[model samples]
Target: MPTLAEQLQTALRQETAVAQRLYEVMAQEQSALQRMDSASIQALAQEKSRLLAALDQQLLARQKLVPNHQVEGAVDALINTFPAAIANPLQQAVDQLRELLFRCHNQNEINGRIISASRRSVERSLSLIRGHQPDAVLYTQNGGATRMGPNRRFASA
Candidate 1:
């Protein structure tokens, strides 16, 4: 049987790999969002979900290996319990995993902004097609600004 350190190391490696893959997927997702590629976006979303689950599982495996796993900074605390030889490499691995996860988070936020902008555009288009004027600020001939009413006509028949 492998030692506790060995098992934790293995689990951390797996988690890092999964996080790296997730970051790549998020990058692809950003590209797809920019191009408005629905098909690729849908497929990438599924892959991202699977990778996320795998990451969670790996984290659980690591948690099981360490006592007091629920405590904040548990992994670092566990690493500190080991000798320098083992602890150093484990700390490096943890740092790499953190960097990957951080990149994934940033990319996901950018993608979300893209999605929100796209949704707003579509909604605006739909409102125009449905003969509804979306809320808008209009400047009058008297150099005054006024809020458009909901019942205002968008176009003439």
Candidate 2:
């Protein structure tokens, strides 16, 4: 069996690839800007449309793999329902890994007693990670709970 870390690593790669496909679709749409030949433009547009749909499907499929939570229900459904193989299995793995990362993130907060002050920092950090606002944060100061997150917490300084 693949190590859990290895499996999760594969998942993260899959996730990044899906994001790259989104970028590629946008890039193809922008291709029309270079030259406006009707055929080439049409081709690029078609390709862009196809990629977007694929991305949407992939998103739905992987989201389904994550265990349910209120905010994540839609995503879970989407991920679960995606059909067939994506252009890249690696991308699918990444999506799954990213989802797992979030699960791990929140699990880290359990039993933590910051309640106010520094607590806001933890909540805000988690929010940002969940939103993919800046980047994905897979850890927190406190050791994780049932899932993987930062394995460290504030030392009793």
Which digits, one per residue and each the tens of the lDDT, describe model 1 over residues 90-119? 999889988988898898899999999999
lDDT of 2 by residue, 1-157 (tens): 8643344344556655655654554454444433344576577567756765765665555444444523744443434444435324544564555665454334333212222434576687875555533333345458543333344332324
Point out where model 2 deviates above 4 Å: 1-12, 69-157
156, model 1: CA deviation in Å? 5.0
List ranges where model 1 is wrong by over 4 Å.
134-148
Q: Give the alpha-carbon lDDT of every model.
A: 0.89, 0.49
